[model samples]
Target: MAELFARDTLSSQRWRRRLVPNQSFTLGRSTQKYPVVWDKQISSQHAQLNWNGVQLEIRKIEEAANPIFFGSRPRISFMLDPGQHFVIGHTEFLLENSEPTMPLPHRSPRTEVTIRPEEIRRTSFRKTPGRIELLTELVSKMTASTDHDQLITIALQQLLHGIPHATDVQLLEQSLDGDTKTFSPIAWDSRDGVSTPGGSSQSLIENATTSHMCVLHVWPNEPDPATADFTQIAGHDWAMCIPLEIKLNQVAALYISGKRARLEGNLTEVEILQDDIKFAELVGSTFANLSRNMALERRQSQLNQFFTPGLLDHVSTDIESYLAPREAGLMVLFCDLRGFSAATEDNIDRLIPHLHQTSETLSIITSAILAQQGVIGDFHGDAVMGFWGWPVSASENPLGGIQAAWEIVQTLAGTEFLCSDTPAKAGIGIAAGQAVAGMIGSRDQVKVTAFGPPVNLASRIEGMTKPLGIPLLLDDHAVTQLQSHPSMPPNTFLRLGSFRLSGLRQETQIFTVNSGEIAWLPEFSQALILFEEGDWPQAISILQSLPTQFGPRNLLLQYMQGFQNQCPASWSGTIERNTK
Candidate 1:
């Protein structure tokens, strides 16, 4: 299948007829016929005509537009050059013969096309220096599109006006079993859909092994049923036949046409019609490659640097810092997988995939956190440390952390993996306080990691979750801050009284994660409550105790570290929590 098409396209009949201009093209006062007018005027400026696969240069400017059409005869008359007639096809070129020339269409090496003066009459030529310029302009505009629909829309619009005779513009997509889903490709372009001579609302595209069959017929029977690859349909005095080449059924083709009442001097002339086919093929290839790159970029943009691609792009220091030289409040989160090491003893491969899936699930949750203005700090071999209030300073880092933890628990616990039924569980810890955030790493791996005492405390609390049979625990700072908020979700938060979080002289207050639809919201609102109550010490304590796991915990850890050293030590030690 791959080696089917040869590089020799000089012998095919698909080459467009080249026009030999005798007189310069006559410009008319017709604003409707040609909407675009280039101010730069330099005739016979080494212009090229691209037909099926041939490239022919026009020595003189007998007449030409951006892409003149020969498929239709003019309602009026136009001048033509004699010695070297041009043909439009996959490429554009001049015919050496004084009379009609042989077809130069092809499968490969789609250039060096030829046409006699008698073969071509209608044609539009742009003043582009070369194909590179034409393709560059197309690439710039097509990729600028925001979405898939917008990209298609713009392409459609350009085709309507750019082509010589294209009407009732429509796009078609192929389906399985060599069938087609008609009346689609509603992508926007410069011009909307318009009716044309050969236009039809209904279309059938047969997706085949080697080639595609596009048939458009009237109320009568199908046209040329015997022809599997190439067939023509003429109804209401209009006809169009498309032959497609396919590889692995990845359906793709370009269909462009328009209506014109007056076609003469070379109307339906083999030279002119062939040119249109080649032109369509080239346009299709250029546009397709350009769009694929744009889509790839768009996908990369949506991902978080750490989880999206764990690769490098633009690493900005100022952009990375939440607290460059001052202080800011933050929320810390700690996430650790329970029984993970034991479960993976013999099932390392199984465990890895499960962990990946869990991490992906957590990544989604973290995106939601950042969407609401949050961040993740670090990932610690199955453990996570996160924070907010820097990178995107919001008063909800603590609450956001809690929300992230609860979501992970619910999303994982409910999911049953077909590959392995390892218990999906995570321990989460939340805190609030001052910390520093900015770029801090070697050239090999530069990232925005946080530092401070609050981060360490969060780590201690996370380590204690399994021992206490508690999946989530919020500190004094998070509890007081979240409770004061009226929009906090309705959940039962039990006051686990006072608890020691390793190395801390005083017993830190903690809260546990529970079930409910709105569990995530409270996690976001916790930071606001802590700051409002003016519990600076407790806030710093909770904020510093972030885990080193992969999701929100990492962000919280970063934020808390950035703030810990800068904040005031004044704190209120009341860690009260409520849930329903």
Candidate 2:
């Protein structure tokens, strides 16, 4: 014979097996499917020739371990295209060859017999490269999904369809000693080759038990599990055994006979045994590096979630390292979502996207605030509450707050909601002062919100429109801070004469924003007077009554949602302004 193919020596590890007094070989077979085998006999050194048809690779005939009646040595298997039998070599073994026995109450869900290859969808792997390697790759993708089970079932189905006489497949696994061990793992590969969903899992944790690892029989019987591995699995029939194992975080296993094989190949199976070693230890170590990098990404995301890019710029150390609670003269700005309540009914289909779009709007403002080194507080539902400076900038630029607010108002005013029938609008409120800044709110409500008079004033201005009927408002303190700022849009704001704020004894000189210093002015007082007089229907009608309007129209569109839609038909021209 040609010298056996010399192959690379695999890892040579010390492995010893304890001899048992009951040292006997079992022959197993099943009537439902093919017989699987332990292939530790696999010689990386030599390639085996395909034999027993396309179903098996032929090994040496003497090594087949054929069954004998006398019973002098270990054991042998038999071909049971009919009864897939397993013959055991033990003292006082059965004297006669018997038919494979069926399990009691055999109407079990897992016992459905699957015989045809087409019964399940399995294509013979004809691709170049390793057959086992292909099996490994496909098997690697399986999870607890039913698709995984279907894959294996399809393979068995195809095998049965081609060799209609074949039945009784067996199962095997690697033992703690890293040796092959076969057993009567349960399965039905005949009627619905898709019977027992053998291996698949959603969690890597569950993979511990369901991974396919190895098989037992090396040769095929006349298309039957019974005679397939009679020597390996005896006295059982009509079932399949699967051995599961995980290697390198990937899993693989084997399948075999079930409750049908009688004398020889009844339940004989192929096995792959690995010692009780921590496979995950090697796996975890490999994943540890990946875990660290993933951890960094998670940390980065967490930080980005809280800080605006502009705010992130000055924050030099890790996010956990510092906190600043005071600012010299930072401006405080609040951007309120106007006409927000009606969105619940008006744009029911747009709830999520609206929220997201709203967040993006707030994000744009936050981004601008961050650009100018401003800090952001928590968003209270429909309103964004935050102060500029501190934590991000130690000293506040009251002008920075005004500029940020002005830019915010301008951005939203000019920008239309892509989803809106009309452009979306918001209210901008600006206030500036020396204020405290530290974490506020009780433990239960602990939020990175701000404190101090400027914050309250900004928040109050955000809602001032309901009373003063303005899209944008600035407290006198804010105006003073921005009086010299270079970026302030040149706009002639209509001054609303001083009025005593509720808490303060003195009047706070406030102003309603009219137009950008560079743009055409609007009739701010008239609109304010109508809205304040509770003539909202006419208030919206008057604005809806404009031609090629100014930037502030966005707020009116929102405010109009709050007013009744019983206005006169003359407004339809502008209403089509949005519908168009």
Candidate 3:
């Protein structure tokens, strides 16, 4: 074997190449074909060198404008001898014969040095050039990868390049469940681009558990009972398997096969050349860590999906902090499907589909609420409660809730009903005030919820929607906040008369938005203003003149007509609710 030491002047970098007998290698700027391509003033196919066993021949392939020099003289072809110099552009090379020669004797008595067997082994291992570089390149590739399967594939490719005799490489991952054990191939590579021992080689995998490292001297040609199936499957003369200890009682094996017999010291030579065992261990540990991290990330994502985004961030940072109770100003929203019960009554065939549609509608509603930074609190039979300002505060909770409610109403309006004759519809109520929010319930079954007047008022208002024939309603506090909010326009809401809610003493002012394009809103608002100002006759006249669609369903109109025959002496327009 002969060696060429190429040195660069500008970068002060050096590269070494071994010249094999009767074989040619190129040096040029094309890295795909040339082994020693560099950023120099050289042609893509600059030169080629062929070693004919004893002597070395160099031929210039490209006619360079600048002369190619051999010992400071321009030459197109020359036979390189030991210690000969050649130059191509700014790069220089020196030829050196690596033939073994006898050691020269010293004139004086030199101290006899003894090398231990381990030291000799270590020295031999280090002398194998590119071993460290190969390991570094493999590690770089592994670290840069995020996917576990891709990492294993990269490892197989690197192994094929690092181990010269390795004709095929396969990684087998072992999985254990109770008394059952299974091995599956994760990645593999072969010189002929066809995987050996493929997926059908289960018997070979079963045998891998018997030993940490297994070597087959005569693989396919002389098959033994222990490895006959594998030998036939792989069709190789020699093979080795190294087990990587990933965890306790769990291992993944790296298998390498070749169609060549092992000469004396061949196994040790292979070990010294590439350190295959260490590489296998690295592959196992890297993959194990990556798998663990991926599982953790998946679990985190699953947990995050269960909470509102604002609450999820807090939950991820600290569970206790997120669960801790705190007083906050909030806007609570309650929404319930109107005809869900009737849609699924006494109909088991339609029950599942109805439930699916309900779930989908709930998902759409929750998405709208969450989009406005609201946290979903609880779910009843056909209702869902959501609130803003718990884990984090919104700039304007009332406006946010109203916007979310509007979006919900719009979404349901366009949604096709799955189990109903009519399009699906829902009633939503929003109330804004101070509330206590936190995780509540037993240790085994905890729930994040809000408590106080705002939450209760929102629920009551939602119940009122069924009788009032309104899709969305808001309380006095929410309307006031929305009016004062910087982002909300003043005319967003139409004020309804004040009413005493069921089970509540104070009269709560109610309001509703023009969810659809209702042409009677201006007249309705004038009637409400007249009713509030004690002009019952004028209010009754405006109410009677309005469309009948706005009469029976309108709570205020119903109250006014009930008192039309005999008006109260001091009516304050406060309609009291008898039931929730």
Residues 1-580, candidate 1, lDDT per residue (tens digit)? 0000001124321111222333222222122111112222322232332222222222223454433323342112222332233222222222332221111111111112232222322444322234344445556766664444434444454444444455433444444344733332322121222122233223222321123433222122233345411212322222223433222223444444333324445454333434543344445544555556555565345336432231223324333242243356777776777666775675776876877866775575566445444556777766767676665554524356656666665665442211113434776677777877555567686555567766776787766565444556778877777776677765546544355555666667766544444433343335425543655446445544433221233333343355563443543433221210
Q: Identify the runs in model 2 with alpha carbons over 4 angstroms from their true place.
A: 1-296, 324-328, 347-350, 353-357, 360-364, 394-399, 414-424, 438-446, 486-494, 502-506, 512-580
lDDT for model 1 comes to 0.43
Error of 1 at 229 (Å): 61
lDDT of 3 by residue, 11-130 (tens): 534444556788887767653323334445777777778878666788888654455789789889899886787988887777766432111111111111222223333443423466
TM-score of each: 0.36, 0.38, 0.48
Instruction: Please provide, for model 2 over 131-242, each residue's C-alpha lDDT reduced to its tens digit, 9 standing for 90 to 100.
Output: 3443343334222113222233333433333322234332222333347322222222433321222321112111223432211112223334433333224433333222
What's the lDDT for residue 575 in model 2?
Answer: 17
Cα lDDT of all candidates, in order? 0.43, 0.42, 0.65
Candidate 1: lDDT of 398? 37
Q: Candidate 2 versus the native: TM-score?
A: 0.38
lDDT of model 2 at position 136: 42
Model 1 residue 8 CA deviation in Å? 14
* Candidate 3 clashing pairs, residues 3+ apart or interchain: none
Clash statistics: count for each candidate: 129, 136, 0
